[model samples]
Target chain A: MSRATELVLADYIVVALYFVLVLAIGTWFGKFTKSTADFFFAGRRFHWWVLAMSCVATLVGSYSFVQYSEVGFKYGFCAMTPYTNEWFVLPLFLFGWFPLMYYHRITSVPEYFHGRFNWQVRFVVTLILLVYLQGYVAVNLLTIGRIMKGVFGMPEVYGAALMALISGIYLHAGGQTSVLATDVFQGLLLLAAGIGVFLLGIAEVGGLAEFWAALPYHHRFPFARFNTPPYLHAVGNFWNDAMTATFAFYFINQGVLMRFLSARSVREGRKAMLFVVVVLMPVAAVAVSGAGWAGRAMVERGILPEDVDAGNIFVAVTGKVCGPGFQGLVLAAVVAALMSTLDTLITAVAAIGVNDVYRPVLPGRSDQHYLTVARIVAIVSAVLGISLIPVFQHYDTIYQALSDFLSTVAPPLAVPLALAMLWPRFHARAAIIAMVLGMILMITALNYPALVTPFAHGVDPSEGYSHMRSLFGLVTSLVIAVAATYLVPAAESAADRLTWFHIPRPRPARRRARHDIWHRRFRVQVVPGTDPRLHLHPETMKELDLQQGDVVYVCDARWWLGGLRSVHAVVGEPDDTLPRDTVRLSEEAVRRGYLKPRHRVILEYEEEPIDV
Target chain B: MGPWLPYVYVYGVGGCVFLASLVAGVRAGAIDLNRPADRRTLLALVAGLLLFATVHAIWIWAASQEPPVSDQAAVALTAETRA
Candidate 1:
């Protein structure tokens, strides 16, 4: 067989193994999923590491694989410009935004809006998310399909179909558990393949210094440059674009938020987010950029043919440099990356369809009934997603198109979401207006690029105008929503669960600490007087070293509110009724702290220095 | 005629509106500052603001290193130098 044929055979074997592994995992973990929560959220029992890795896999998709490579080819090191935008958005997401969802027990992002604003807000927000997610899934499928075509000379539709089938089977069998566990497995493969290809390609291109010297200085910089070709324009005016993208991904996107929902606690969600920011994102920046850099270097050196499409650079470089087996791993990695995201989108779409739409329409359905509907919805979503392959395929670069699409649709929803969570006074009517007005303004902006030229630069009259729309809409939405809120009547009890103050927090159970003054259990006696003050015997006070007036915690030995104690005043009263090693408890103190007379309570007193 | 003028005009009005809404929300009890989570979120907001300023400052400096020229201008300059 020829070299190309050999690589194809290797890809087949590797892809086959990948499918089997995914299936085996689904079969193994499928038994554990017993309810809608288990299927949709992995029963909220996922550890930080599982959630972290799964989240990483979801964020770094096949689109990133191809797009980062494409950017690296054109802009050299400046490809990281987009990745660095996440850093600015991370602190808020980790500390503020994600914790709200965790504390609110929100299964979906729109549910928060429902509780905060109204059903209309929830419905509108869900529509926006579903549209964006569908577009997102289509863009990813198109990119992965293109990769399969470029590398193995297969048809794009075949690649799309194969992925749709494999992802659907596993997701249908095991739901979120399968998606998450496989994501961990696939996430590892992604890092290895991404870094591996970069290393091999770097060696092929001579060295790192040689690669830098080959590219222009501007190409190496991460800041804005408007003068480059429309494709290579490293437009650094990222304030609005960054804000929109970062907020939408972490806060608005259900697929991403679902990963956080799977985490055990808000603390775990925070840690998982930190893992993405600190560990995965930095390495991914280098790995994805390396392939394109190598592509640029090799083309300049005449090692490979020039004039390859920018999007094809990643696959082209890896195919030429890596061995057949390594090529298979890269192919599997790309497929894994694609499936990881696809499964999440499919699951999220189904969840929104059932929970927000179907289940709500028909209340009191069995968990199994919803589960069946969820599976059916997943299949329908995948089919619908595959049908959109051609729509994204027409774009010059999938990344630019995806960015523009997200910018247009996501900002309208993100504005209301951010406001609803942070500013509780955000009116439901205002949210409705913002969603409508923002969409109108953004879509209108897209239609009329001439309106934006005075404000921005190099933006084509036809495309790349979404950023301008986002900036305009985000500001306008907040303003309009705030204004409308004042005009409207205030909600009687919106803050009970909607705002930060009203959300329930788990109070720590009281632990019993050693009463150092008396390590052993001292006898407790009831005082005859109804003074309600806990009196200690003068001899007992001397042994326990009680002062004239000191505060001590009287804890009921048995369960009182599951180990709650009450504070009481200690008086050193030499009582004849109270015997040695006996402390007197007033009936009132016993009733107040839920203690019984002679209930063997521990008298905890702060230490006072002995009289020297 | 400066490019920065439009940015300032648009963002300035937008910022004012956002601030107004925030104040209104607080007064209406829509925004509860007393909640622990809300207070923590305020701290995050402060940190995010600092981060945004710092990142943009760095980007502005880097952008200044190379003059703001169009892709056409750069291409024309390359052709001119070759001639």
Candidate 2:
């Protein structure tokens, strides 16, 4: 009997419960998503742990389960190459990409482009982002669909459509809040299921000793295995394609960037990235690759048939090892992996579409209008994703296809993005040229590989093409960017705010005594938004002995561990929204001071204030 | 802590992961164990872990079942090895 046919009612119950649980989370969080900020960015209130778990879940999609298993079936422990590559790139991301997004308060990757480069760069990059993310979403859907087809005898297209609809319902209702809230559970589910399957598969295959004995010598060691047909050579592909491309993923991918951006503070963002690198990634590496190793052993032992497709190895092994009750949970976790990634991508695509594309064209629309458009874009993204299923259907394994797609597309954009931040002289014109030229070269290389590599001899010339493709694109992009930067006049002012060197450093405060003539008092009020300045009522400003043009130094009520109390220099914004007794501080200021509302603050202006 | 110890270790690790997730959620204020509203989310999470652990236990039992090797397949394997 087929494994799907053997599924008991208990397994079905578990799967049904998981779906209901995720939907309930979506419905509950929908109440909080009243504004664009709440929906698109989760109101930037995600704690470090939530961000960390969500990043893990988002990074390890259903494709990770299937793709890594497929590679494991073919190459055993070498399946870990892609995941272990994360360690080398994690430190680079922390010091380089993490700060660029966190400090700039960026909402999207393209927004960083718009800030540093020009609208032209932003628009073009957004198009590239849409294609990449949309394709990524579809690949995940195809993976989930294949699993459902194997487990339930469902048609692949229908199953994919159903999953997409399920994801869309939640994403449409609550947006990123629903995505992050559910992601915590989904992340844990993925890890538990991954580990559970590995342990169970090992036991079914007569424990680790017998399992290892069944495999050939080539599949035993992690690093010693040379590249065979239809696989990349470790030396070039490991560093160039795997490490460099994944660095681009962490640095510039919108889904990953959004998680970092959603952290309450840069400190939290850094902590979250550290969690992904130090704790979760190593476990993840083993969890994803173990299934395939077990499958290879079972094949050798005459249990599993040799005819099984490498891509189906994960589900096939799970079906063999897991009983009815356990089968349901494993299946649910697979669905969780798919939903977790698809929801994030759906919202990311919509976010970029609205913020970078639609809103720009239809500027000054009501928030309600944009919010409505954002919802429409989410639906449209899902539909487009479902339409793209046929494209992914042709690939032998999701990992190979994704690597090829990302290696070709990502370098063109990632090169220019890195240059814009690290090289301050990088001009807008140069960024546009680099992106355009790099894309053309990457496409040409992909379409015509023999022109690039004359020594190709494997049955599949494209076997180890990822690193080669990336090398061509990156080198061409850098050459073009450097040439264009020197050739064109630079946009120094635009580049200043975008680079790492220009991050705002808190300056030492000039303190005056409480009895000083410049000292003035106002009650502090908590305000929303991230601006650093203080707002004073026109009447309050008049009472405080201040004018619109006069500069005032505002200090927080109490001091904390980092030395002197909070201080911000501001020209008073006199507003009728405030009563004369109160001075309004942004929410960021409140957090900075660790202050309660209605607390008293001292605003000190020079007795003879200098007018700007 | 006898034969069940291996199972205990498996379920115990699963339990710890569940507890850690809960603690992380509470600390993040994504779930507040104190609030009645957040208590539902906590319950759902606990239920998921329990269901997962229950499944793990079931699989552990099944894996211990010692899958039968067919006689003909064993003969074919022996012949192939000798050849």
Best by lDDT: 2
Best by DockQ: 1
lDDT of 1 by residue, A153-267 (tens): 7888777877788788877777887788888888888888889988787788788777655555455555445523444343323535456777887887787888787764555
The TM-score obtained for chain B by all candidates, in the order given, is 0.54, 0.50
* N/CA/C clash count, model 1: 5
Question: Which docking band does candidate 1 fall into?
Answer: incorrect
lDDT of 2 at A461: 56
Per-prediction DockQ scores?
A: 0.11, 0.02
Q: i-RMS values of the candidates, in order?
A: 6.8, 13.4
After aligning candidate 1 to the native by TM-score, how far in Å is the CA of B28 from where it should be? 14
Give the 10-residue window scoring lowest on summed lDDT in candidate 1 chain A. Answer: A506-515
Backbone Cα, N, C clashes tallied per candidate: 5, 0
TM-score against native, each model: 0.71, 0.70
Q: State, as a TM-score between 0 and 1, how close model 1 is to the true structure.
A: 0.71
- Across A1-612, the per-residue lDDT of candidate 2 in tens digits comes to 135437799988999999889889886767656667667877564557878887778878666787888888887665665654444444335444665666556778888889887888888888878877888888878877887787778988888999888888888888887888888788888888889988988888788889867875546544422233435445444435454567676877777777777665454566677667556765787777778988898898888998987878887888888887887887787788788988888898989999998888889988878888888899999888888888778665765656576777777887888777666778888888888888788788877876446323232455535454565676677888899888977655466567655544322222342234235456777768876667877766655556555545454444221111334345546789787767787887666444456556666653221111
